[model samples]
Target: MRRAIDWAFRDRRTGAITVAQWPNLPLWLFAGTSLADWILNPPGTVAWALRLIAGASLAWWAIDELLRGVNPWRRFLGAAALAGQALVLATAGP
Candidate 1:
């Protein structure tokens, strides 16, 4: 158990503790907020569907980052998508 835990959370090269295995927190936050808005306010069916798709896409990106690897371009793209989603939600105004 200890060995498995160490392998999962520790950097093999430096032997230091790392949170590198976890997904991007900001991505999770944005998705969570978008989902909450959909649940609480219930936008028009079309808007709600769009929001759901965007949120799911962000989640897929997060999982991809974890499973594949992190890259600066991925971070930038995710942030841009989050911003776009926020803008759309704001302008639409539930």
Candidate 2:
């Protein structure tokens, strides 16, 4: 189980990028949780915090993609989603 969890967080791929690869599972889980929170709850402190965390996480994913040169599509999508989330969250009523 520990090995599996460790595997979840480590990426050892080195070569041309392939579509077969998935994004980091643990990060995706965290991203999904934040996205679900936004989908399920009213905009407030908790929601804002979740969005902030989500945006940051997505941004990290994007940067990691850039560094690894693995998935350009994921990087752009993550960056765009992060920007939109940050914009809406920042503009939202308190």
Candidate 3:
């Protein structure tokens, strides 16, 4: 049974399947909780934190795409927007 479970999870293409997909439940829970809190209180600190995180993630993804040599202009615009959002979050006071 254990071997079967492991085989099922093992990535056939790269042979490097991650168990993090299941173990990051707590992270997803925290994200959901923060989203709910932001929905209930729009201009709260938690909302700003979430915004900052999202902006950073966006910028990171944009940079990654650009590094792959895909759509320079699109990535630049996306990174710029994300940086602006991060700046807004930074300037927002608690």
Candidate 4:
């Protein structure tokens, strides 16, 4: 778990621990926070924003995956995740 967090939160471009170089940190952080919010809190603005950002980012990633994905399953999963996120974003929160 520690290794996973370090790998995910690390600065990919610089191979260092810095705020400026984390490309996917926001996405990961939003996902984590969203999950926690789902468990502990009611839907609200934070949930909306988190889903909106995560959905939009994943949608864009799906587009890229469709174009140049490494494998068939990954592309399929990306598209599916984007769809699921979009659905949740649209229907969730107030």
Candidate 4, which ten residues in sequence have the lowest lDDT sum?
Answer: 17-26
Model 2 worst lDDT run, 10 consecutive residues: 8-17
Off by over 4 Å in 1: 12-14, 19-29, 32-40, 69-94
Comparing candidate 2 with candidate 4, which one achieves the higher TM-score?
Answer: 2
lDDT of 4 by residue, 3-92 (tens): 765554454445554323233544465566567667867567776676566566666665665454444444555577667767876887
What candidate 2 gets wrong by more than 4 Å, as runs, is 1-17, 25-30, 71-94
- Measured with C-alpha atoms, the lDDT of residue 34 in candidate 2 is 79
What is the C-alpha lDDT profile of model 3 across 21-54, one tens digit per residue?
3423333544665576567776667766775565
Give lDDT tens digits, candidate 2, residues 1-94.
8565434343345534344456585369566867688579856777767766676676676556555533555444556655765687689796
lDDT of 1 by residue, 20-71 (tens): 4454654566566676676776658856665666566675664554444334
Query: Which residue pairs does candidate 4 place in steric collision?
Result: none
Give the Cα RMSD of candidate 3: 11.4
RMSD of each: 9.9, 9.8, 11.4, 9.4
Q: What's the C-alpha lDDT at position 59 in model 1? A: 54
Order the candidate numbers by TM-score, best to worst. Answer: 2, 4, 1, 3
lDDT of each: 0.58, 0.61, 0.53, 0.58
TM agreement with the true structure for every prediction: 0.38, 0.51, 0.35, 0.44
Best by lDDT: 2
Q: Total clashing residue pairs per candidate?
A: 0, 0, 0, 0
Residue 62 in candidate 4, Cα distance off native in Å: 2.4
